[model samples]
Target: MAIELAGRPHRVPEGSSLADLLAALGHAPQACATALNGDFVRREQRHATRLAEGDRVVLVQPIVGG
Candidate 1:
């Protein structure tokens, strides 16, 4: 299935979850924040957030400031 990942088209196995996508990309989940279709998905919920075709997903570095 194809979905928009980080603003680019990405393909993954069917029924792939947010966690699976992160693992597939070799990204450490703890080091970034994720969102699906413009909604923030908490780290604990990544595994349950199943991705759909054409979904917009973004994984970005978390802002750290004092």
Candidate 2:
């Protein structure tokens, strides 16, 4: 399956979930926030956040702005 990560395209394994995608990108679920096709995906949803063939996965770093 292929997903858009930060505006770029990434080809990932089929049936991959948000958690799986994060791991593949060297990111920890606890350290980032995500949105799938404009829908905010909470931490608890990671496991159920399956990536479709053309799904878009947008990951953002935790906000720490002063």
For lDDT, the strongest prediction is 1
Candidate lDDT scores, in order, read 0.94, 0.89
- Compose the digit string of candidate 2's lDDT tens values, residues 1-66: 777888898999999999999998899779999999998999998989889988888898977889
Which residue pairs show collisions in model 2?
none
Q: Which predicted model would earn the best TM-score?
A: 1
- Per-residue lDDT value at 65 in model 1: 95
| lDDT (10s digit) by residue, model 1, range 1-66 | 999998999999999999999999999989899999999999999999999999999999867899
Count steric clashes of candidate 2.
0
Candidate 1, after superposition: displacement of residue 12 in Å?
Answer: 0.7
Over the full model, what C-alpha lDDT does candidate 1 score relative to the true structure? 0.94
